[model samples]
Target: MADDYLVRIGKLIRDARQHRGWTQTQLAEALATSQSAVNRIERGNQNISLEMIARIGEALDSEIVSLGYSGPMHLRVVGGRRLSGSIDVKTSKNACVALLCASLLNKGRTVLRRVARIEEVYRLLEVLNSIGVRTRWINDGMDLEIAPPAHLDMEAIDADAARRTRSIIMFLGPLLHRLRQFKLPYAGGCDLGTRTIEPHMIALRRFGLDITATEGLYHAQVDRSIAPDRPIVLTERGDTVTENALLAAARHDGVTVIRNASSNYMVQDLCFFLEALGVRVDGIGTTTLTVHGVPAIDVDVDYSPSEDPVEAMSLLAAAVVTESELTIRRVPIEFL
Candidate 1:
């Protein structure tokens, strides 16, 4: 049993080395050991000590064996501690997910500045990666650099990742422009309780998309000849639904008007991104939007989405709740 464990660990080390395109001799030099010693370790013949195991993990940049940790995070609070100064507001999860899905519209690279690193974003990234979208966090995870492949592999979509976030439904808008037909697993998140997907369906159907939800999957079929012949009035002004409409409209060639649209923070961010892709949007921060959609967009764009208004308001609420006099910077007051 011990010999079997050694063999598995050796294979892991060897696989990591090859994945990095590192030669056995190069790994030996990094560890200050001969190639023969590295060979013995790879073959599970070397008696590796704990210190050497730690060294090997450090060189390979992975945890071969972890003690692991599990606990709920706690905040240490001292009573009556006065709070002062200001903190910059972070990005929005809504905006980040919208931006990530909208990246499919551009043929060139898309670099988003100061995106929030949240669970929603990570879930969307997993879905993107599974479908061949290459995304990386640069600038200490403050920014995201996304580069799409020549084509997305829809068959390999990550169903588990897709089901983790309701934001996955927003992908329908951009994807309708890419493929004729595809299936996405049902969206599940936050226990929001039978939130009507009808509004999204009604809005997207105007852009030639027909979606049917059955047996734990949504089958989407696109009619390429069909485009929004008239204004698309959303049934609800929900942020995610509005984003879905905006995404579908981004790749449409003619004028598309959306009424009863959301004037929330995330919708504004999506409009700004569409503009960067050369799509002209007439109304932002309003209930009505007139979008002049270009037939095709292939621009290498860089956009910095605005800060989170909800988080900013939370900071203000914190001051009132705790009776603390605090200053908050970079608040998007218009949204508030």
Candidate 2:
């Protein structure tokens, strides 16, 4: 519905451009779109991205969206900044969510070191607290401590928070151990194509996890008696799917080696945390992972995940864009 309305506005923009006797190339140059894109919008064909809409509006010297409905733009420049100060890398968000979900495996307290104080973590923490996980911030919200939750308070879940992140799907891996059946809100992340939860369900099905998507949430049921008869191979080399598989395997009482695993940055961080919890993870930096899941795992572990290369790139980009030089230390070049 919203898309239809937006496309209608594209036509209006095209018509306006035409009324001014502008060629498709001329209009494209004005709107910063390629001639093909301008042609598509004029024909009511192309589905526009938000970035396109902004550029078009800027080119047309007209406002596609109403004036009152916009957030202020923000940009910061360090001005060729080279840092002499030593800055410690913050924990990875990917690892933190996986660790938080895995914490349910333990009946004791879980303390995470230097957790990122970003919006995404706060959303997961909200969902955790709603599910009866006792999480608190120490050292001014830098250090996070979460106590084992008796069970997830399913009804109290923050739907908005859960829906705002793709990591919410990871909860399924840990939740299956604690509940026979539960539902998780559908994932939300980059505005990319529809990513199926089937990979997660398929990998976990070996562990007796049965999930069905309805409306907008993933409905799941776990048959504790069912364990994988052999190795689990992921359908795609996705990062989150691998984490879900690891979290499930972490509590499975046997030697489970995950084949075709994604040795991504987040996965490595999770492996580090799992190792700290006494779970043996072989092939830490490779596609194949041999996980020796311990039946009983109770340990106070504080593991620091390295910095995000994406954020570091963004900082470096800010420098390059403004003709500045910036030194980003502790960049996990492995991920880069």
Candidate 3:
């Protein structure tokens, strides 16, 4: 038990260091410790003290351990004691997934800078790598590089891996281009009410993707020859659905007009990224979008997704809870 604890902490430390783009020598300098000590800690070769852990976390700019957040469940407590410290929000769950889906378009390696190390992204990566995508944890698990494979190993897909995340739905955009026929376990994420896959279906229909839900799995069949004939109209102001439509449109060979599209932050990010990949998207930051897909995309694009607003709000809430006056930079107040 003690060894596992150190290993977890060591992993956290190593992850934080890699996330920060720091070398062991740099981390050692920050912590005022020897590089050998940092190496041993990352290797889980030595026992560390709580004071040392806190110092290491401070140097790494990560909490590493926090109250109210545990594995498996998001625990919320109504009645709580007062505090005097402050905290910053992490990142948005929505934007992270959108970016993950967007990574599938590039032929060159896609490196997501400072990705949220949440359970949600973890599940998507698991599913992505399982299907022959070369996903590497380059920097202490913070930097993610996703590379496309010549042929996907669809049978190796982790049903249990993807079923835990709603982000699995985003695979529709990437997988449609990779496989004509495939099956994925039903998506499960937050209980934020009924999030229908109907929007995804409506969006991808223009690209000839027909997905059917049967026995806790999504059976999808794609006929790539069928392209959009007319403008695709969305049913809701849904963000993910709009993104799915945008992604599908980005890869199609002709121009696709999408109506009632979400002008949400995530969709905007995805649009900007698509443009980076040489897909011309008009009416961005608006309800209507026109996408001109590339017949073949081979550009090595590098993009940094914007900061999340919800995370900024959570950080503010932390300041409120602790009754501390704190300054949270890049709060993304525009979204609020």
TM-score of each: 0.72, 0.70, 0.68
Q: Whole-model lDDT, candidate 1? A: 0.84
| Residue 142 miss distance in model 1 (angstroms) | 1.5
Candidate 1 local lDDT, 80-161, one digit each (tens)? 6557777889977778889998998888899999988889889899999999999998988788999998889999998777
Q: Rate the local accuracy (lDDT) of all candidates.
A: 0.84, 0.76, 0.78
Which is the winner by TM-score between candidate 1 and candidate 3?
Answer: 1
Count of clashing residue pairs in every prediction: 0, 1, 0
- How well is each residue in 1-336 modelled by candidate 3, as lDDT tens digits? 448878888888886675444689999999888999999998888899889988987886667777574568767878555555445445556777888878777776777766777888888888888887888777787667788877778788887677667777888886787679998766652221245777677778779888776545678899988988989989887888889888888888889999999998788888988888899999998999999898667777666676787677777787788676776765664745
What ranges in model 2 sit over 4 Å off?
1-85, 189-194, 311-336
Put down candidate 2 lDDT per residue, 226-321, tens digits, no spaces: 998888999988988899999889888998879989988889888888888888999997999988887777777676666776776666666566
If candidate 2 were superposed on the true structure by all CA atoms, what would the RMSD be?
Answer: 11.3
Total residue pair clashes for candidate 2: 1
Which pairs clash (backbone N, Cα, C closer than 3 Å) in model 1? none
Q: In model 2, which range of ten residues has the least summed lDDT? A: 188-197
